[model samples]
Target: MNTTHPAKDLQVLAESLASVAKVTKNLDVLIFGAGLGGLAMLEVLSQSEHVSIHSIIDISEDAPAFQLAHELGVNTSTDSSAELESFRGDIIIDVTGDASLRSKLIAFKREHQVELISAKSAKLLFDMANQELRSERTIETQNSRLSLLDCMLEITLQLESRPPIHDITSRSFADIHSHVHAISGLALIFDKQSKAPQCVGAIGENAPDCSEIESCQSCNGIILDACSRLSQKERYKLFKPSIQIKCQAIENCYNVALPLWQDTRLSGVLLFDIQAPLSKEQKTTLKMASVHLNMTFKTLDHFQQLEEMAIFDALTGVFNRRKFDMQLHQEVSRIKRMKNGTLTCGFIDLDDFKQINDTYGHQTGDLVLKHIATSIESCIRDYDLCARYGGDEFVILLPSDDAMQGSCLERIGMRILEKVANFDLVNAPEIKTSVSIGLVTQSGETAHAETLLKKADEALYEAKKSGKGCLRIFADEQFHYTPSKE
Candidate 1:
């Protein structure tokens, strides 16, 4: 039988479930009912890391537990009477509160010693969710008016990637909206340079039309067209601190316009007036919002940097084999679309890296890899790609518009010889490490990125046979292998 639930509800349920699942890696779970609450618990369990949400049980195969579990990528089926010994769950949650299932688990405990969490225990998760939200809203033990941007940042923190957005949005809608108004009744974003406010996604009443701040025409007769037209530094002199902005969006917007500056350009304005002018607590909100935004952006940027680092060899700081595959897929799409794009790839393997590791220990061997990475980074252009393709293997890509990839590879090979010769390993004994390079290029789309990588790999093997520190280019023969993204 086909079961039904609102899509929004399902999405929110899924997300929340994913969040819970991320907390643990192992789950021997036997759930009964497959109803809303049961699916929610299951969703939380499956999205978790190291935890596998075992099958959920209910009488009907098409029940919410069965359907939602499939969506969450879990193995699921239905059972009328779930037996603890016969089933594969570490802990069984009796969502149905069915005495039979509970009895089964209790009986098992007497004979085999089993631990179980009741359906009632799930309520703790909701309490935890509330605390997370409260912490996000609180600003250093002070109160303040919140901007929309600040609210968005806090919302992100409150949620882990586990919950599907749909589930979290619906479940937390009222709380989220109320939280929004509590921060700012109407948050406005305006462009500081041009004095234009644009309407991005907004929660309160004061939301405007455009996504950026435009000239404030609210009660305006005079238009402040550009940053050059007014000076924010001297404007404070006239209004005795009431002039919060020295530069104006002209005069009408002075009461509520909060400038958002990023990189010296007006990203937008976060404007709000609150109910009774501005309370000190409300004022603190703006300060906190700004602080949080700066940190949030930095955190996001850092996550990206860390992701890039993950694909790198610890010593070499280059893309690993996993990254090569991802990059190859992207390049394949690029070449498929254009039909004519520069695609140059190379594979380089360090000669005697293992011997060096065996002789001087991994510490000195690491230094050699570090020095090689630095040398390679300096020689490659900004557009050229570089990555550690696992072990002592390295790969590089040059998508040039005009320069010959062969010529470029030759120059890099000679430079590596020179760089390797001038060895300085920080007081460690002098050691030698060299790279065998293989290069491949295509001016037009004839093969996929995987094929190119294969050719490059084969060429590198040929390079090793020819000599340890030489370069080889792909010729008529082509091989196929998927490369990782860098």
Candidate 2:
């Protein structure tokens, strides 16, 4: 004995009926039975885009297909002859297998000039339709898979260059929009500093600019709430499996949000609106695209971490000694090639940093180091380079032409001193912080990275000797001191 799968059989039957209806032009079908065969035909034909089911009839009003026809808004009756008299259909399918009903249908067909298919001939037509449906579905599936593969390949190639996150977001939105036919789309990433979701990319009219604003006034509160919920770890897990919510902004539209995860943490979100519901295959395709997006984010993050480790100081978040040396060499060569260019190097050391650590703790010492580095960086010009040479020591490189004077250097030193003097530990309020800076200016005649560093170091020694919180400049073979007062 062979057992049949009910769900699969129903799907196949539905596809076959749809295929038959599609091949005929605006075919109006009247099904004459409400038992198993009629019920199956009605179920599939009702959903066909090209076919309209006119009516279903049987002798018994309690037939299974009557309930379904009523639910589907199709006409139903227990009087076959009465229904046939009123029927204005192109074809009548008699699945009752009744000799008397067939004879009546034949007479009706002859008088009304409509085609009539008996139960045995109906089976043959259904078999042909089933074969056609299977062949069409095979071609469609192959084409869909090829299209999906092409999309994934393009995304992978674009990611290989490691473009900015915004570029990645826009490209991904366009790719997904092509397949999903969304009305509006938004890409958002969780900002670590703000601890909120920031919209990086948006498409469609009336889209809110949540990039810099604290809250989006134009966006629906429900949509914003959904975004906020997905940003949290616990809440993200609740909707992590699948999320589809009604869009309050657009009537009869639904919003779909896909979470982009970096390992266990939720990194970002992909959101879009759909006017119609998605099929199972379409949903699977979207899941695949989202997974690819997640992998792209993870890859970018790993590369950025590796780059930071290579060129930045771990403790202070400034350029490390090795990177500074490389920059020093490059700047020296660049200045040498120019006509009468000068490079100014400043050597900075935190005053009483060791005392701060000994008095408070190593953690406090680390904070002080970071604070000084930030202060120095904030005071310098955009083109200047700041680096951590060693513990409690930083170097700044400023390149200028011959007309550049010492007054500019004096102003930079004073700003750094002012910024550092304002530093006070939150818990250890009594702890004060200041920096001793030494500046040296080198002209085209004597512009060497090593020599410039040496002169800066000598000036730094003089500044320390004069007072811990002062600035000294070594220029023209003489030492000039600038006290930290004003």
Candidate 3:
């Protein structure tokens, strides 16, 4: 009393066949039985690149192998004699383990001149196919691992050059996309203080439009929500691994968010969308890559700290004397090449600084020095160099090709004096301080860094001698007093 619904069966058969046709093969096979052995054989043969399942037969229509063969798009039947009459395959694989069926197949094979593989031989062939499939998968996994390692090595080498963070993110995303076949990828660098994404790098045709601030705001919520799900322990780890999250923007896809860390802090996140679930090997590759990215960020940050320490004053946060010496020489060389360019050097000395330190203690004097450095920095252009030449002393270099070089120097000097006069001490508002600046300009003349500095120093001596709190310029083989507009 088992009636088959042919219409529904045909529909299911068509859909199953469509999905299976993704891989094609050549050797034609006809299988007997829908029992456990037959199901196992079908499973193994379906993955083989050289085998094409032609038909499968079993007495019971509801057997496992019968349903599986139907799903795989192979022809199936309950009546073995009827199917054999129409069989035009290369081989008959009898997995039913029935002696009577075997005898019948032997006679049919002799009469029709078709190959008959007995139940035992068929089982052996199935085992070999299964082994071959496993070997192929092993090789594929090894290849994928090697590719990921090579990519990490390339990125590590690039990091040594200390390229911009954007370059690192873009290249890393592209490589991951190519290797993992992700639908799209995005990398976000978070601000260490704000903990919000400060920069973004996106790739792929389906990437979200996050190039502008307004557009990026839409994704911020999603990324932060994903990050919040990680445990505190995971976030603090240097190689915080990637986690899977449901992709809200794209249906039928999921996102992998890899947390990039710099030591104990969360630095950034790399997210990519994948259409299918990743394999074990793919997941391993991603975890290893995330570790490499974390190391890269850490190395770059360390290098930046070292570089700043080497060139910047720890107290005032301005270029130190050593850096000033290096820049002065470079600027002198550049002026020499121009032949008609003007170079100006100004030497600054804080007047009555020692008395302030002796009266209020060195701590107060330190604050005063810091304030002076900030004041001078505010008055200079981006191209101008300001350095703490020594305690209570600063130097500035301005290179220009304009004819109003003297007037420009005067304006800068006036601005510095105005800024310094505005500084007020919290504890002692009555305490007053000022700077005496000596400036020297060189134009269309042979110049040296030391000679320019010496001339500026001489000009500074004149300013200080003129009762301090004033500016003097040495130019045209003479000393000119730059009257303060006060």
Per-residue lDDT of candidate 3, residues 170-207 (tens digit): 67777777777777676777777877774466677655
Candidate 1 Cα deviation (angstroms), residue 84: 90
Worst 10 residues of 3 by lDDT: 235-244
Report lDDT (Cα) of residue 365, candidate 1. 78
RMSD of each: 26.4, 7.9, 8.5
lDDT of 1 by residue, 410-481 (tens): 666566556655666666656756777777776555747767887787888877777666667774455222
The superposed Cα distance between candidate 1 and the true structure at residue 475, in angstroms, equals 3.2
Q: Per-residue lDDT for 391-486 in model 2, tens only? A: 999999998866357888888888988998888777988878888899999887678988998999999999888876899988878988896653
For candidate 3, what is the TM-score?
0.81
Off by over 4 Å in 2: 1-125, 142-146, 181-216, 220-222, 229-252, 261-268, 275-277, 326-342, 350-368, 399-402, 414-436, 442-451, 461-470, 476-486
Error of 2 at 338 (Å): 6.7
Using lDDT as the yardstick, the better of models 1 and 2 is 2
| lDDT, model 1, position 225 | 31
Q: What is the TM-score of each candidate against the true structure?
A: 0.43, 0.62, 0.81
Clashing pairs in 3: none
TM-score of 2: 0.62
